[model samples]
Target: MPAHIGRPVIRLAAHRVTTDALLDHIAATCRDADDPTKPHPRLGLWKRLIRNTGVEQRYWTRPLQEATAPSSVGHRAGVAFGDALDLAESAARDALDVAGLDPGDVDAIVTSHTTSWTVPGMDVHLIERLGLRPTVTRIGLSTLACVGGAQSLVHALWHTLARPGARVLVVVAETLSTIYHESETTPQSMMYRALFGDSAGAAVVTGLTDETSADLPTGFVALDPLELVMPNSRDRYWGTIDDEGLHFDSTRKAAAAATDAVPYITDWLGKRRPEWAIVHPGGPRIIDDVVTSIGLAEKAGRYSHASLAENGNLGGTAVLDVLARTHDDPPAPGSPGALIAFGPGFTAAGVYGAWI
Candidate 1:
């Protein structure tokens, strides 16, 4: 179970859109479709949610108007897949550089993405783009949502543990803006529009051959007793695709589910309290709930909050963004830290680690 994860590299979409622009677009789109004189009843609610998201701006593959414009499902899927590949390729290359390795040095490539569907997936494309060895093992994971980034690290850790001296490249990328539909004006749709952003993150995990190689950048040696919890509460959040577009269903109960699962997580942690709590920024509410439930210090989740306030939620790649920031400003050496992320499974994935 000895492995070291390198510093994560993040690639954001080219266009940065503000929450105010998004609200204006939504209002204009709704007004054009309905009565122009009277304001939509839910408009105020949508504005409040967007303002309260704690996200001042978010990056997207395209401008706000183009990204949220009415479009055929097929067209949107094609565009999103292309954008995902572009971002993933950039992030993977930078990660390999950070690890002081070339594409050929990677023994395996693990990827997590849920915004687009394609036959060989983004993994194969990365293998080709990065010039990874033909024999490199590839694993593609989908539908894990925000938890996918942390889960990818778990997968990489196992790969290194099972294959000695192995070096695995893990990538988590999402183009959530492409899934936005102008036709769906529900609160969930508005929330998704306001909160979701496009970004990609990558990391390199190398098996610890011996104690000497423990001088890894970022103090990312794997911690023992990694844990993944799934409460079988999938109904709390999900997405469906239809002729119109992708629709997301996320209930207020999602936050409650996370809060309710805290005791079980604490029991698993037992007596060890991490000095740094790296919780996913699902939103402002989820962060507050997790911090309060787990009794983390007031500023323990600053990295997660910073990611949310700066980038919104990058879906599966959100946690990794925070991780990258944490590595840049790591905790004191020998201090313990925990990584936590929640997603569509209504599941929480956590791993405890120590700074080098």
Candidate 2:
């Protein structure tokens, strides 16, 4: 299909929580209450994991006390949904402003999230809250994990391609911290606790026929979006819902899986190498592996590193956060850029875009 997607304009909204504060909170809460002789078994490992996450701070939807408190799944779900709605609305409004459009102008809405689940989903709430047309086409993607943001844009691109002149708003909002609990001390849980945060991002995508097309805006024009799901890799990384709440499990080989998939991605990209790369900051290891596997220059991972260090992982919104950073200090005009994100199903979603 022709490149009908317009420049994607994004807005990121985050909560407040520094890495130091969160670590301290964890240490305090995880201490053994009955046995002074036995410190938390994972204390040492937690410290190391937090330090290695390349994260200095991250935001949360709930206050520190509430987030760290032991809460039921029901309670957490309620809080997360409320917070997501507010953040999503704010992000969508800002993105619309940047695109110089109004809610009524949007023909479709694609919402992506992984932190919370709701019956009507975020799409319905967003429409009611943002005053968007009730008849607007809506797509709600709750699963896709970290790749949700990029996938939402890809879906928006298809929407615009199918219906010329359609204005699609893509919103990815995640409040991962709301699910954190001090009681869960598994290594994987600790790693997630240290690395995940609450954030929401929105982007506007439309069709453009030429560089001078009236629909073109001061944003990155998406092109050649692609997605790949590794075969038989569904068990590599996934989440489960238990009585306590949602639990994420990833084998130590998660990064290796991503690295191994790079060659296939390169083959898919053919000869196109983006000058700028906006990759999901899956972590320090995954970022390094991607840079090496794709043969991208080390500098190409700068934005991804900065996003990881500053905001940790925003789950579904991480890629959009990186994209927003590029918007503030964009690459050379017309420079090709790559947007990539990884998630459950051991999937990789990518797109090649050019700065407008």
* lDDT top scorer: 1
lDDT tens digits by residue: candidate 2, 1-356:
33433333343344578888888887777876677556676688888988888999887777788777877888777888788788888888888887788889999999997876798889999999899999999999988879998899888888878886678898988877865767788878888888888878888887665542664645677777888898888867788776667778778777588787787778877888777788899898788777766667777788889989988898888988888787778889888877888998888888787887
List where candidate 2 sits over 4 angstroms from the true fold.
Answer: 1-15, 32-34, 210-212
lDDT of 1 by residue, 21-60 (tens): 8888878777633667766778888898778888989999
For this target, which candidate reaches the highest TM-score against the unseen true structure? 1
Clashes per model (N, Cα, C within 3 A): 0, 0
Instruction: State the weakest 10-residue window (summed lDDT) of model 2.
Output: 2-11
Q: Which ten residues in a row have the lowest lDDT in candidate 1?
A: 222-231
Number of colliding residue pairs in model 2: 0
